[model samples]
Every structure is written in structure tokens, then in C-alpha cells.
Target: MSDAAGDRDTDRGRDRGRGGSAPFAPHEWQIAWRYMRARRREGGISVIVWYALVGIALAVGTLIVVMAVMVGFRAEFTDRILGAEGHARIYPIPVVQDDGRRVSAIDDYDALAERIAAVPGVIRAAPMIEAQVLVSRGSANSGAVVRGMRISDLQDLPYVAHPELSEGSLEDLTHGIALGEGVARELGAYVGDMITMILPGGQATPFGMAPKIKTFELVYVFRVGRADVDRSRVYMTFEAAQDYFNKGDTADQVEALMAHPDLLGSRANPTEADAALIRAAGHNRVLWTWKDANGAFLSALDVERAVMFMILSLVVVIAALNIISGLVMLVKNKGRDIGILRTMGLTQGAVMRIFFLCGAGIGTLGTAIGVGLGILFVIYIDPIFDVVNFLAGGGIWNPEIRMLTEFPAELRWQDVAASAGLALALSYGITLFPARRAARLDPVEALRYE
Candidate 1:
């Protein structure tokens, strides 16, 4: 037994002799990495290491997915709302009430519309008049907004794209009237029903109180699925609305639609700039972007994203804790080895760097794993959402159609970069405590204890 022990030590001495110059190399990183690998192998990359990695990975992936889904819901819902309504509406300044009076403007609106359309990134620009009116079919009465639209004006807008035809066609839109599906259901009126609409007339008749009453056959019924607009929107021809609202020849406002609804407020694109310019025009008109139109919903999405990031960052923090514990264990297990290295003229900083390399190795490995999982889940998110929706009985399949029918996803490189950078930074940050302790070890005491 003694001879075997002696031979073992002799062979260890020879191996150490052969590799003595390894640590003296100019490329300290290469030498430090080699040493770190040897120590990590000795410490055993156990099942616990894998569990820690998986935990971090799952946490990061789930955070990313949840954030994306929230974003998807917001984006999808907003598009539907914008489509049903219109993007960027311009209303004349000083909105008049329903008093018995008339507000008149002699502005050359056709020339203005032409000039507005010529603005870069302005896709479609059209004049509109919106008025609240009480619509009735028989004894059933429903309140709704009567919007006057020109077919040629909003041809490029998404509101008219694949519009759900519950009753009459788009051609009949000018001749008769179109009722929202929800409105039709509530009023108990169908396609061929004639309805009476009462608008608050600006002029008082000589015989007591008065409001304008007009009759029209319900020509079409369209469903956009937004609860607010679906149940309260009634569409009429420009001429019909003019006579009803007592505007004679003028519309109350103009509606414009842009290309991308996502880039608003923050990004200064030409589309947003043009919308601003039209708003800034001295025509006493107020221009509103989609952001302004749906500020509440958009703000909710932003708040949720920030909250999710703050919550998920805790997982990275916990992973860093595990790294600290693991490195401390390694230092305790290699106490005698560190003392010997110190005796062999390894500086305190070098000792600290060696341990730092160990912790960094774990961080690098775990970060790679987490990032890989996040990417994989993001790539296959649609299928995953479908499965989830299918199992959940498709509760959101038709979500008021304020957005999109299908689940929409967009993987931004900026999000990926931010997540990966945070993970790596947190990983590197936790090693300092353990590395400092390892560097300050008393060589005499460590050797004596061994």
C-alpha cells in the first residue's frame, strides 16, 4: 500500500513537471480556461447543475412567451379596433353642441383633402360626419353613432377590407343604409327592415320642440366584433348624413388611415409627421393618430410588458445565487490545491481570476442554454398558442374582432438582445463575492489543514 501511494505521488509530480510551463504562457486566458476546465471537472457537473440550467431556461422562455402573447393580444386587438373605426381622424376645432343653431365653414375641403392625400405616407384621406342618433324599428329603439362616409374616399382603408356582409352589399351603402350586426340583433331588425333615425336638429320648428327624423331601408349589416362599435355604429351615404345632420354641404371631420399602426408617437416616420402636419394646418382642425385614438389600451400593453420584465428578472437573480453557492463549494473542496498554487508563486489576483473563470464558465453555459430555449419557444409560438387555445375551448378565437382573427407574432431582435445581455451580465456579476473570498485564503492555514 505504501509503495503504491509513493508511485502515485511520483507520477503526479512528473505530470505537474510536464505542465509547469502551461501556466507561464503569454495567453493567460488560455491557461486560465484550461485550469478552470480541470477544476470544474473535479467539482463534477452534477444533476443539480442541469436542474439549475433548466430552471433558468424555463423561466426565461416563459417570460419571453408571455410578454410576446401580451404584445400579440394588444397588437391584434388594436388593429381590429382601428379597422372597424378608422385611423387618425381629424375633427374641426370647437365642436358645437346639439343646440338649436348651425355652425358653417366655407373652407375648400376638396382641395384640402387632395393636398392631405399628397402628404407622404398618408394612405387614404376622406371626409366624415359623426352624430349620435336614436334609431328605431317598430317599438324597439337603439342609440347609435351615424357616420357619413364616401365609398370612393375610404377605398384604401382596412375598414372596408373583407367587410362582413350580414345583409346588403357595399354598392347599396349609398342608396339605403348599413347597420352593424350587433345593432341589428339588438333592434330586432334584419336586412330588409326599414328603420327611422332621429337626429337632434339644430333648428327649432315653429311648432314646439323638434328633431330631424329620416327613414331608410336597412341595406347592409356588417360585423367587426368590437362590442362598443358593433352595437352602436350606423353607416350612411354622405348626402344622407348631410341632410340629416343639417350640415347642408359640410362634413364635421376628415378621417385618414396610415400604413403601420405600431410605429406611433416614438418613431418619427413620415406617416406620423404628415398626420401631424395636417393637424397643425391652420384650418382649425384637430388631427389624431391611432395612438391618440386608443391611448388607454396601448398604455395598458406597455405597463404589462414592464411588469413582466421586472418579475422575470428575479429568475436570473436566483440563478446567480446558485452560481455563487457552487463556486463557494468548489473553493472549499480545493483549499489545499489553492494553497499549493499560492506557494508556487501564483499571485492573489491570478488566484482570484482562476475562480472567476470557473463562475464565468457556468454563467456562459447556462446563458447559452437559456437563450437556446427562448429562441426555440419563440420560433414555434403560433403552434403553441393554437394548442393552448384549442385546449382552452377557443375563448379568444373571436375576441370582439377589434384586432385580428388569427394569432399574430413578431420576434424583434431587440427583445432577444436585451434578454441575453441581462442574463450574461447577471451571471458575471455574482462571481465577485466567491472570487474575492478564494483570493484572500491564508496559504499557511489551508496547507496545514490539508
Candidate 2:
């Protein structure tokens, strides 16, 4: 037994001899890693280590998935909402009546639309009339907003003009009405069907007031992928909308699509120049961007994202506690071995690094697995959501309440890097105490006690 012990010490001496007492020496790594493995008669990596690994992996993955989903939701809502309304809307400066009331209407808007469309960075400018009306098909009736726009302008909107999403041709849009998907479903109306539209106070008669009622074929059924917009909008030609709404040769607004909506009014693009150019074209208008229309909603999403990240970090912090626990256990269990190594000429710093490697290795591996899991979740999110929805009996996503029909996830590398950095920081931080404790152990006392 004494010869065997002597031989083991001689081999350990030779292992450390090549590298001296250098920090992160190859032999130090070898000893650190070997101590983490199990042998038939000796303890190895702790149950606590395994638990810590699993916990860290789960916490990191959950945080990544939540953050990605939040980002995706924000992006989807912004795109759909902006698509439902153009990137910017041009409202005519209201004309003051002689009696002090404001009369708002854009007169000779076609020329103005053409002029606005000619502005740099402006993709398209469309004249439209929007009014509230009640729509009915047989026993079904619902309130809706009728928007009159040219077929060409409607087709210019990518969200509403998809061949897969629409059932009819754009050429027929002027000859008939277009029903949003939600509105069509609510009214049980389909393409080629006639639906009555009643505009209150649309006409004045001897009976004091009369609603202008008309029917037109439902030549188009389309979706903008926004629940509220689809539920509330109906479309017709600019001429029919003007005639029906009694706005003689005028439009309620001119909506413009911009090539870079996010850069609008921002320092990069400075849409003030665009505004100046539009004004130079001889139009008196009040402008509002998509950000103005949905600022509050987007702000709420930002707040939620920040709060969730903070809350989920607690999970990682708690998991990191497990690292401390496992390291403490490991240091305690390896006291005899540590004493033998120290007596064999291993430096205190070397001992510290060995144990640090143990805890940090587990953390590093766990974080890697978590990141891989997060990426896979984002890539296969649709099928995963469908499976979850199926198991939940289709209660996962409701378009009416959530405003979007499907679950979404957008994995950003920045988010992934942030998550990885957080895990590593916490891991390295918690690991130091126990590693230092192991380093400071007195070889004589350790060997004597054991």
C-alpha cells in the first residue's frame, strides 16, 4: 500500500513538473477534470452538480424563449397595425366655418395624392374616405368602417393584396365592395354575395333624416392579419365612397406608405424634409406617423419585456446558487486529494483554478445547451405551438383577444449573447468563494483530519 501511494505521488510530481506552478497550466486542467469523474471506489461529480446543470439550462432556455416571443409579438403587431393603416397619414387642415365650426375635408385630393407620392422616400400616397356604417347579409348584421380607395392603391398594400389571402381580382374592386376577413365571417358573407350597407344621416329627406342604404357584390375577401382591423374595415372605390358619404369631390385623408417607416422623423432620415417637400407641393395637412398611432401599445410591450427579463433573471440567480452548493460539496469531498496534491508541489492558485474549472465547466456546458435549445425552439416554434395548442384543445392562441392568430418567436443573437453573458457572470461569481476556500486549505490539517 505504501509503494502504491509512493508511485501515485511520483506520477503526480511528474505531471506538474512539466508546467511548474503556472496559472491554468495543462496539468491543472487535467487534475481538475479528473476530479470531476467517478471511479468504482471514489466519489466524483456531485448530485448537486447535475441538479445545478439542469436548473441553469432550464432557466436560461426559458428566459431566451420568453424574450424571443416578446420581440416577435412586438414586431408582428407593429407590422400589422402599420399595414392596416399606412406608415403616415396626411389629414387636411380643417377649414373654419363662418359660424366657428371646423369643416375638415381634403378637396381635389387626387392631385395632392399624386404630388405627395412624388416626394422622396414616399412609396405611395392614396386618397381615401372613411365612414362608419352598419352592414348586413340576411339575419347577420355588424358595424363596420367603410374605406373608399383606388384599386391600384389597395393592391400596393402588401398585407392586404396577397394572392393567397384574397379570393378576387383587383380589377373588380371598384365594381364591388371588399370585405375584411373578420367582417365577412361575422356576416357569413362570401365573394359574389350582396351585402346591404346603411350609412346613418347619409341623406336628408322630408322625414327629417334618412339613412342611405345600398347593396354591392362582395367581390373581394381579404385579411390584413390584424384581428381588429379585419373585423372593422370594408373597402370600396373612391368614387362610390364619395357618392355614398356625400363628400362631393373630397377625401377624408391621404395616407402615404414610406420606404422606411421606422426612420421617419428620426435623425437618420429626418422626415421633416419629406414634410417640407409635401408642403412645398401646395398642400395644407396635419401629419401623423404609425409611431404616433400606436406609441402607447408599443410602450406597454417594451415595459413588459423589461419586467419579464428582470423577473426571469431571478431564476438564473437561484440556479447559480446550486453552483455554490455543488462546489462546496466538491471541495469538502476532495480535501484528502487536495492535501496530497498540495504536498506534491501544487500551488494554492493551481488548486483554486482546478475547482473553479469544475463549477464553471458545468455552467458553460449548461449555457451552451440552453442556447441550442432556445434556437431550436425559435426555429420550430410554429409546429411546437400547434402541438401545444392541440394538447390544450386549441386554447393557446385566440385572435380576438391577442390580436394575432399564431404564436411567434424571433431569436436575436444579441439576446442570446446577453443570456450567455448573464449565466457565465453569475456562474463565475458564485464559484469563487468555494474555490478560494479550497485553495486556502492547509495541507497538513486536511491530511490530518482525513
Candidate 3:
């Protein structure tokens, strides 16, 4: 080769390090991979790197599992809330009485509800009368919320109307009352049993006030699958409620069901755009979506999810830190070898890359293993939860308190990706300092005593 060409080649080699091969070239990878395998003298550092891999794997797996559970919570709660409360509620603007009492009497709500139901994405809009009362049958009693709707409108409510979601018959719901499964269980009432409803603060008498009392036959029972709700909801006919509550011919509010309940919100929700359409359909009085009531709970879950992730990521960070200790040891042990390579015209870049690759190898393997384990955990969450409950001798979860009968998990790809990416990034990022140190080691100093 010509002297000028040789000089150019040498300059390029010096700039890149070692053979000055292409960025992450085959030889560089080969050398890096080989260095990852430890010799007997380097056994201590090899063990540390192994620990790092395990640590990263465990951390990532935990992150995925925790996030999945949080997602599951949001999902389960959302499902139950929508089924029980519907998507949106339309209330008449309350008028303040002379005594400063707020009274809601939605006049002519039937036609208005039909108009709202005709809006895009709306499934059902039923005019309803809702109030709190005490229910009793025989010797048992419980507090309940009475929701009064027409038999036709009851058919429009998803959980209440569905044959699978409810038990007994809706044939006589117009004349009798339908109690929740839990309420029936508590009262030991049967489908044909008579149940008495007591409304407090009723009828101005010689004393303060007297309670209004009424009785109706139990026609059916509904199991909404949510403990708190199933135990408290009681359904009666709209006409019966009007007479019982003495509300004349007016209703309280209109509960509107959407085809996609979970999507009704601001924040890029698909149903957000249809909010205007529903309002423009006919009426736009006191309207509130499902999110308004439950938003605080969901927000708390999100904050918890994020906090848990940040806390769990420390495990991966600590694991990556282990790489630094191991690499530092390796650098100390490989001082003589580094000197020899440097004297032989090995470039600093190659030396740095070699060590960087070592850390990357561990991070990649660990992240993959963690991701796999997390997915498996989420898939078999129910069985695992049962086992855990058994180990704890049962009663680890209360349906009435937690509002769910079973433990839930939902694996999301974004969660997995975020976990893996974080682990790898920490692994790779932590590698740089040590790798640079190894590359910058002066040949003369490295070999001075050797």
C-alpha cells in the first residue's frame, strides 16, 4: 500500500480504537461476548454480574405484576360502576324551598329521556325515582336505596334486566319490589315474600314527624356482582314510587346508558366528542358523566401506580449499580491486558465498547426473563391469588369492603415495554462510567509495576 494510504488507515484505526472496525462491528462483539465469560481469577466479579441480572429480572417482573393489578383494579371498578350507575345522569335543576330545602322534580322527563336516548352512542335513558329507605321482611332488616322505574325502563337497565345478571322474575316488578341478592340473603326473603319499606321524616304529626310505611311483594333479586351495590339496591315500579314518595307525577332524574361507558370523558376519550351531541339532542340541564363521581378514586390509583413504579425501579437501578462494582473489579484485574492491547494499537473506543457490551448483555437477558415471568404471573393471577389467600387461611379480601369478589390482573404492553426499557436503560447507562475509565487507562501507568 502507498505510504499516504497507510497513514490514513492508521489514523482511522487510532480514532476508533483497536481495529477501528465499524460501529459495533462483529469482532468487537465477539471480543465483548468472550470477556463476559469469567475466568477463575475473575469469579467474584462474575458472581456480581449474575446477581445484577437476577436483580434486574426480579425488579422488572415485580413492576409488571404490580402495574397489572392496578390496571385490573381500574378496569373492574369501572365495569361495576358503569353497570350500577350508568354512563351519564341528567338531573333537574333543584329549586330551593322557602325553608332552604332543595327539591328536585323533573317534570315531563319521559319524553326528554327519549330524546337523550336518541343521541349518538347512547343506549338507554330511563326516567327514575331514587331514594334511601330501610327494608324489612319477617325478622330481618337492612338499609337500601330504592330505584323506581317503569317495567319497560327496567328492561333497559343492563344488569337489572339481564336474565344472567338477575334471579327470579321481573314479571311482577310493576306491582311488587325487586331486592338485591345480598338484601334477600340478609332478610332471608324469598321471591314471593312480602317486604316492608320504611321511609323516615314523613307526615307532619302532633309530635315532630312520623315515618311512612309500605309493604310490597318481592318479585325478583338481582346480583350485580358488586358486594356493596348488590346488598343495597332495591327496585320498584315508577307508579308505586310516585305514590310512596308523594312526588305527584314528576320524576327525580334520567339515567342515560352509553354503548361505551368507559369511554365517556374528556382527556381524548372517544365519547367526549359525543357529549355535545347528547346535550344538543333535546335537554341540557344538570348533567354529569360517570367520571365526575369516581374520578378521585381512579386518579388515586394512577398516582399509586406511578409511585409504585418509581419505587420498584430502584431495584433495577441497584442491580445496574452492581455492574459498576463488577466492571470496576474487572478493570483492575484486566489492567495488564488493557496495557498490552493499547501498546498493540488497540483503540480506546473498542475497549470502552467491549465493557459496555458486557453490561448490555446482562441487562437484555434479565429484562427478557422478567417480562416473560410478569406475563405468566398476570395470566395465572387468579390461581396465585387463591393460593395466597389459602396460605393466609382465607379472608384476605372482603367483597363488601373491596367491592370485588376476586383478585384481578390485566397485562398491558405499554407497562411491559416501560419496565424493560427502564431496566435496559439503567443497565446501559450505568455501564458508561466504568467503560470510559477502562478506555482512558494510560498504558504506561497500567503496566508500570507489571
Q: Per-residue lDDT for 253-331 in model 3, tens only?
A: 8888888766667333435534653564445366677777777788898899899999988877987788888888888
lDDT tens digits, residues 186-285, model 1?
Answer: 8999888899988765456888668878889898887765667668889888877887777777877777666755544522334556446465454676
Q: Over the stretch 296-326, how does candidate 2's per-residue lDDT look in tens digits?
A: 7888999999999999999999998999888
TM-score of each: 0.74, 0.90, 0.88
Regions of candidate 2 where Cα sits further than 4 Å from its true position? 1-21, 39-45, 99-101, 265-284
Sort by TM-score, best first. Answer: 2, 3, 1
Off by over 4 Å in 1: 1-48, 81-86, 94-107, 118-121, 136-141, 163-168, 184-219, 223-226, 258-283, 340-354, 389-408
Q: What value of lDDT does candidate 1 attain over all alpha carbons? A: 0.70
Which scores greater on lDDT, model 2 or model 3? Answer: 2
Identify the runs in model 3 with alpha carbons over 4 angstroms from their true place. Answer: 1-20, 96-102, 163-166, 201-209, 262-284
Clashing pairs in 2: none
In order, candidate lDDTs are 0.70, 0.83, 0.82
RMSD of each: 7.3, 5.2, 4.2
Give candidate 3's total backbone clashes.
3
Name the weakest run of 10 consecutive residues (lDDT summed) in model 1: 263-272
